[model samples]
Target: MQQVVIIGAGMGGLAAALRLQAHGFDVTVLEKQPRPGGRSSVIEECGFRVDTGPTILVMKDAFEDTYRAIGENLNERVEFVRLDPNYRIYYHDDTHLDLYSDPAKLAEEVERVAPGSGAQLARFMADSAAKYALGMAFVERNYTQITDLANPVALRRLLQTRAYQNLYRQVARAFGGSDKLAKAFSFHSMFLGLSPFEALAMYSLITYADLALGMWYPLGGIYRIVEDMLHLAQQMGVTVRTNAPVEQICIEAGRVRGVRLASGEEVPADIVVSNADLPYTYRHLVAPEHRRSYPDARLERMDYACSGYLLYLGVDRTYPHLQHQALYFSEDYRANLDAIFRTRTLPDAPSFHLNVPTVTDPSLAPPGHSLLYVLAPMPNLTAGIDWEAAAPVVREKLLAQLERIVDPDIREHIVWERDYRPTDFLHDFNAAHGTAFGSLSHGFFQSAYFRPHNKAPDVDGLYFVGQGTYPGIGLPMVHISSRLVTERILEEWS
Candidate 1:
């Protein structure tokens, strides 16, 4: 049996481990974190359970297919509840919108908010569905080379998808150029750490998935998915070792030999898979001379995704107005996005994703208490902001904003509090430029075959599975990436 070593027990790595193990490889997963679920890990504080990363799970088919590959039922292992009115959008106009998965209800809401929009909403859904179908087909598979872009069939499909239009434009045209509704639809790009104005129009597929497929929550929390994956991995006889930070990917004459842990233990393997942040992986783990394609200067020149400022609070009281997920848009949405991605500065008025998980899964908090997760998109570490000095000020402002928006005197009721900065993402996960998600933003040039391939260009027996590689970010995308990578490995080994 061929020995395989996977670095970073993220969702992608765990999934790859299971798939590769089933393929008859001896698989061992090494994680720097104390536990599994790289970005999807849970943070426990004073009995309050909060998912520090990836609060929502979308695209059920990808998740279902993953478990089905091993003849296991994901539903049986983890309870999934579909979220209707997926998210409550609190706009800058003091008006709120509830995004429903049901088309009829959504049309009604659109018509109510913006007159004569019911028909437009229907048309938008139909067009978005087409984009979703095309986009998923394009992303779910692997991209081996740049020439794959020139494939006639792929080009035809791409042209038909109108991927050249850009997401904000597509959404604006879909909603009769209504900025508010457009923003609601197009903002899904931010989930991938890309600005709607700049991210490919193909990404409108995200909004389609959310509004059409509906959002979902596991019974225990998002981290429950991680726990379940870990359980499945262990049951399959895959060795999973946590707190085993990989110091380097041991390469011998341009081929993977194994990995060296920070503890000075070297684990030998026939193949190495990395689910760590891509830029960081190439720059830090793989030695400079051995790297043929990604040199230090080239890695530094790459455009990375924006980071986030996260605030997790275990509050004594629940806000009745809060839903499972809510987003409070900054007054000037475009300007804030510019600040994060273009100017590389903190948003003076930050738009935030507010998740009150206790509303959906009350067990996450004690009786009468709630868990609030606030994530504000900010520039990555490249911005040079003094996080240690800025965190306290930002925390006060954020708490005040929450109080003003949701509850008065909300801060007084907080029983527990913790915050994660961009630097924390860098120090903890080796995330490039302190990006909380994964690799570079999904720009047109930075996406699809243009993104890093699962199989390294020059390194034999080395693979990558995670947000940095093809079929980029989001839990579903990572799942897809893992499957694609495992399939490649199986093919090569067979």
Candidate 2:
């Protein structure tokens, strides 16, 4: 039997473990934290369960594919509740729009905001759906070399998808050049940690995926999916351990031998896969001699996704009218974007995403209480702002904004509260520059074939899976990345 050691039991790691085990490889996953899930882990505080990262589960097909590969039905293991009017977007002008999965309903909302936009909305959805289909086939696959980008089928799809056009521009043209409608449609790019104005038009498929396929919430919170995968991994006879931080990847000559834990214990392996932060794996985990292309100097030049200020509040009361998910756009949405990605400064009126799971699952809190997960995207640690001082001031600002939007006295109901900053991501997850998402922005140069490959370029028997590698950020991407890596492993062995 071939011995395999995977570092980090994150969603990607767990998926990889299950797939590889089914392929007859003996797999063991080592996670540093006391629990699994990595960034997606649950935080149980004062009787409230909050998902530490990634609240929404977009693209259910990607998730279902994983279980289907192992001859199991995902629905039997975990139940998912589809959210209609997926998200309520609050604009600066005190108006709101509800994005629905049904095209007719969405067209109604679009026409309500901008006359004549109903037809445009339908056309945009059809175009986006086509782009999404093409992307799934040509773009999302694993890439081992630059030549992979030159495939004729992928090139044809790229042109058909208008991959050369800017996402913001594409939405503007499709929606009859309405700024309001364009912002609403294109802002989904931010979820991938990219500005819509700069992200490739190919990414507009995200909006299609969200409004067409719909947003879903797994029962017990998003962390429930993680729990399910972990349970499956252990049941499949895969060795899983927590509190085992790997200090180094043991490399012999040019191939990976295994990993050395922080406890000074060495574990031997015939294959090794890392689901840790990509830049961190290259900069800190692997020895300097083993990294040829990703030296410290070159890595410093790479652009990273912005981090965020997170607040998990368990309130004594619930907001009955609040949707399952909501985004409050700042008065100056573009300025807010500039603050985080361009200027690397704090936005005076920062936009925020608010999640109140009680709207869907009241069991997360006391019968009448609620759990609020607030996230404000900000510049990563590369900005050099002192979070220790900024946190309190920002918290007050966020509270003031929440008070105006949520209720007159929203702060009074806070019975329990906690926050996570960029520094915490750095300390806890070894995320380079405290980036909550992962390596290199999703620009043209940093996407698809241009993104970091799954297999390490300089070493044999070593691979990567997760947000930092190809297919980029988001839970669906991570799940697909795991499948891609597992297939790569199978191909290498075969």
What lDDT does the true structure give each of the candidates?
Answer: 0.87, 0.87
Candidates' RMSD to native: 1.4, 1.4
How many steric clashes between backbone atoms does each model show?
Answer: 0, 0
Ten residues in a row with the worst lDDT in model 1?
148-157
Instruction: TM-score each candidate.
Output: 0.97, 0.97
Off by over 4 Å in 1: 150-157
Per-residue lDDT of 1-494 in model 2, one digit per residue for the tens?
99999999888888889899999999999999898998887888767898989899999888888898778888898988999889888887778888888777888899899988998887788789877876777446878667776767757777876867999898999988888888889988888888887788988788989988888999899899888888788788999999999999999999999999999999999999999988889988888899998899877878899899998888888787788898888888889889899999977888888888889998888778899889999899989999999999889978887787677788788898999999998888888788876656788778888788889889999999998888878889988998899889999996
TM accuracy, model 1: 0.97
Give lDDT tens digits, candidate 1, residues 178-235.
8889888889989999999888888888999998887899998988888888888889
User: In model 2, which regions exceed 4 Å deviation?
Assistant: 151-154
